[model samples]
Target: MSKALSKRFGEESMDRIITWLEMQKISKDVALLDIGTGNGVFLIELAKSGFTNLTGIDNSSTAVELAKAIAEKEEVMSLKLQVADFLHPFPKLSQYDICIDKGTFDAISLSPDHPAEKRSLYQQSLHSVLKEGGMFLITSCNWTKEELVNHFSEGFEMLQELPTPKFQFGGKIGNSVTALVFRRK
Candidate 1:
């Protein structure tokens, strides 16, 4: 059986993003990203939809390698998984057409104190990767959509705020979970 994640990080959140991806006329050539990409499961789904320009980045080496293995075993060609820390300096900007951050900002926001750094890192990392006029989807529960917009909207414009995503608990399968969505403008 596959492992499970907490209710906050469950499939409901992914399904929300998939809806956004579907709304996009995802072609075989547009770049797609899954930042804080744990195991690259989200990228796998996007790849399944014929988005060939899929790239995934994670902070853990083991996770990156494991995601690569899983992608290989599944024969997925629309992916390039990497081990990268968003806290550090990043490369050139205007790279990808769309950036999907499943929960990277949420994890950073969960840290004790340091809202300034949390917001800054979110902006810089996102800035360095996304192309002008590209789409960025930030999924989180650590902050409400309004909070996320207020804190990180200095560089990014507010495009759209989708409804909150919900899921069942990992331990208690009957309970439900909710998460917010922010789209980059």
Candidate 2:
């Protein structure tokens, strides 16, 4: 099955994402990376919003295939998809203007019932790919907005917290959710 990552965060999240991207000051040609991207929802969405330069990475074989098919079917010419685990060591990145995650790190932040592990995992996994001053936006149900700010504060500057769209669950269900937008320092 394909991963649609229905964690809620939706269209209302775009203005926040786009605004954060602008503050990062990534050039028009800068590379945009979506880590733990499942089925390429944001990649396709961003492309339609005028961001043609993007790449999405997922650990699932099926996800990469689905994302590819979706990209092709959607006529998204610039989005690239690959398979890779976030926990494993990845080759160094020399470039990238932004990195976005829809809780891939949060998913890994589990410890057989331990919840705090996700914070550490998220910090390290994101460290490798995020360029100096690159932007980061993460959406999670595990931590409150304030907690997220403190967690990423070590390497990122708390830029802004857009009211993440609602979900059917805790916040708002089915409202195309909301996420914490940040800039790497």
Clashing pairs counted in every model: 0, 14
Model-by-model lDDT, in order?
0.71, 0.71
TM-score for all predictions? 0.80, 0.77
What's the TM for model 2? 0.77
The TM-score, computed over Cα atoms with residue i paired to residue i, of candidate 1 is 0.80
Which candidate tops TM-score?
Answer: 1
In terms of lDDT, the poorest run of 10 residues in model 2 is 1-10
Q: In candidate 2, what are the lDDT values of residues 29-98, reduced to their tens digit?
A: 6688888778887788878767767888888989999999998999887887888876664684336778
Q: Residue-wise lDDT of candidate 1 within 1-185, one digit each (tens)?
A: 12465544557677787886678555667887787888887788778767787888888999999898889888896588888877674673247878877667777877788957876876887777777777777766556656766876666776776666445665543223224333455
Predict model 2's lDDT versus the native.
Answer: 0.71
